[model samples]
Target: MADDGLITIGALARACGLTASALRFYDDCGLLVPVRVDGATGYRYYSEAQVDRGVMIRRLRGIGVPLEAVAEIVDGDGARAERLLDAHVAELAERARAAAVVTRMIKEEIRAGAVLSAAALAAAIEQVRSAAALDREMPILAGVLVESSADSVTVTATDRYRLSTRAMVPVRPSGAAWSVVVDAGELGGIGSWLRGLDEVSVWSADDALILAGGGTERRCGVIDEAYPDYRAMLAGLAPVRTRVVVARDALLAALEDRGAAPIVFLADESGLLLSRDGSACIAATITGPRTELAFSPTTLRPALVSAIGPEIMLDIASADAPVVVRSATDGDLTTLVMPTAIMNSKENDA
Candidate 1:
């Protein structure tokens, strides 16, 4: 009956420092259920692994978490659950503005004093911070997705018009394999805080993420909605019909120089063209077939800015297909620009 990796309901309650009545209430409410039950004896048994979840449930209830919200968190919808907690934290902050009430109390209980821990390189965080969708049309795009696999983590963002990604290996290798869509602003805060450090470690609770390092501990909310299938979008891309290499700085400068003019793009056998008001043109040398693609400058500039390298490859399949942008220096990075046509004249650009 002892140390068999399974325990009676009473033992589980005691193990998590909760009382029998409270556990029974939680079970009845459909929040946490025992792993096994002895129907004949009318007794329940819980798995040892569930101890952490039980403790989390107890702490959440103590803080006045609503029954529905608590179930959301317990059921692995932490992002949505975290948003509810954040509302509670905001109310608490207004009342106790100077105190670390939410930060200290919730972090300790959620972590159970064991240091909820995961690590990622600072370089990757910066990439995600920069790529966060600025346009608010798709609210969920406002966050960066941090996805972990057995050997790597990918940080990505998109704005429907443009997509950016950075993939890298984690430093500590915890194999926790957790994924979350975190607010772009929060991610930027993390990257800024970790600027001088080579690496950073973060811990996630059901409703919040505790960032700990450099004598600074802060809590931020997790995004609740499901992230878009950006990986699928990036996977089987259109064929590259015209792949031309140009200096990243040159292309960005060209895009930047178009002032007070209808932005236009003309890619031909000689070069890529950017012209404003038919006054002058900025040309990036190219060695591809003559291809005229018309799209707004706003749709493409982000990819050029993110490339940040000596050379950039603009992969184009047709006038209507998405164009792929790549940095010559970093192969692991990529940005895709969705093609669009102007209302007035696609012919004028060509």
Candidate 2:
């Protein structure tokens, strides 16, 4: 509307889909200052070239981005802007997860109690217990997740690097589904006590897990924390490129010999080879193409030792992808072991 082809503040506001007053506020904040200001009437005007910038600022603010973040995103280079946006998104996700946990804690109700074999439940708990994280910042990962339904009870735990889960058929299934996360240290002690009992009846109420059996009852406080979406990670795994079935004890012994060093696994039609500078070979029933992967002995040995059967099966998607480990004869327990790196990276560096 200005004579020199500069648009008035009102026109720029309409073009950018923002109110005149909003534009004035941004101008005052030095975010979208107008191109010109009339000395006589104190009127603000913007150049046509500034319209795109105004629109971008409006869009950035629309997403609830704080002005400081918005300034970083709008005024910084592409990579810096991307990093800022990603950080903002991660913060939002964390906040949302916390909110969801609080809401569930307030509104959730436990419908029925579950009856399960005490020995089997205890074993399941021990199998996955080692996967719980010890991070002070993430107290949620310090607990094990237990979910019960009409048919089965499943326990799962993860320390970000690996995850283990076991599903057991209940002696008497709950009439309704329920879930709770109990601290791993407390659960381990409870499991030890439960091992002596024949059966245990468990239920959740008021954010606590109560187990009753043999004329004795014990209660453990449930963690009011948000757990990571491990199911999504499991479901999103790529198709297995190689599969191998090998003796669990033999593999466990080989890993034990490796001590704390990293181990590389090389699998082919002939068999599977385990190596850490020195090498040991185990006969295996292998399918698919030859594949090689590496893992920390500490990270993988527990998974083999905790398996229920004599033989363990591994499903590998890639050298770097998470390897699925389960018992060949009894698949009730499953573990995902994340590879440290490909063999080439280790051998070449060494």
Candidate 3:
């Protein structure tokens, strides 16, 4: 020891099991600056009491905390620092969970191999799509909503949260109008079949939607009742009265940063309100505000994340009603989101 209350930088590094260069880096970062520097020899010294904090800094950095975050942790109140750490840990956990699900799906697909029938594959695709939306508690449902006409065949699924409709026209098409509701699992099988071939033939028989593709056939049950009057819903929507040009990624990032789900819609005021824990609120600017209606960040964020568009157009009736979001690039895609009433603007002052 150099003195009763001090140690040379080298001694401190050895005691903390950190390289000298790492210590210097920490000092440079203001994370663990030495207490004194000798003017003559340029030697550095640290207080013995810094050993615990040094160890903590090393451990935090080992776990991949950025230098700036490490500085915040070191200087901030214990509770706030702990909250940041916990949030990061939670994010890691969510990512791990998502990875595990994908891994399991890949493994299952491998096990099934080419032996899996086309119908089975289509069904699998449908299920995965449903799982992605359902996991988020979005009310809209997805299925092989089949409609057969003399000219073409249409299969569609919409969450209303964010509408995505995919259609395939069979080459040797069945020219009949048929409506069916296939479970996600069954739709996955149909999706699998659809993938194997450029076209598929589908028919409804005995309450099942039968899809035949690449010589493999799959069948799924029809939904009991007609789908909600989706056409009527669309008709009820007011025309686009206001247009706001926003950078899709910037707005999306901001919403994600605030943990709000993105919803696309026209609002009376172009503004975003983020509500957390069901009460705390944060307000953000909507690129255009006067003509369009306002939307909750919670609803808009998810839609933005799911949107595959360079620009989104929102159509709204008023600030208090459901808003429709249409993709500028894709005319077929639409998203409908009900706005949460804003009783007081002060709630979202942040």
lDDT values of the candidates?
Answer: 0.69, 0.86, 0.58
Question: Candidate 2: TM-score?
Answer: 0.66
RMSD of 2: 21.5
lDDT of 3: 0.58
Tens-place lDDT per residue, model 3, 100-178, is 9999677534322122233433533442244224442432254536565555544455565544343443444443455
The 10-residue segment with the lowest total lDDT in model 3: 276-285
Kindly provide the TM-score of model 3 when superposed on the true structure, using C-alpha atoms: 0.48
Listed in order, each prediction's TM-score against the native is: 0.59, 0.66, 0.48
> Model 1's lDDT to the true fold?
0.69
List runs of model 2 lying over 4 Å from the truth: 1-111, 276-278, 343-350
Clashes of 2: 0
Q: Using lDDT, rank the candidates from best to worst.
A: 2, 1, 3
For residues 1-350, could you state the per-residue lDDT of candidate 2 as single tens digits? 98999999999989999999998999999999988898999999999998898888988888778998888888999999999888888988999999999885554334478889999989998899998887767889899998898899999999988899999999989878888998888886887789879999877877788788898988888899877888899999999989999998888877777667677788986689885333578899999998888898878987888888899999999988899999998889999999997556546346
Q: Which RMSD values do the candidates have, in order?
A: 18.1, 21.5, 28.7
Give Cα distance to truth, residue 336, candidate 3, Å.
1.9
Query: Largest TM-score belongs to which candidate?
Result: 2
Q: Ten residues in a row with the worst lDDT in model 1?
A: 112-121
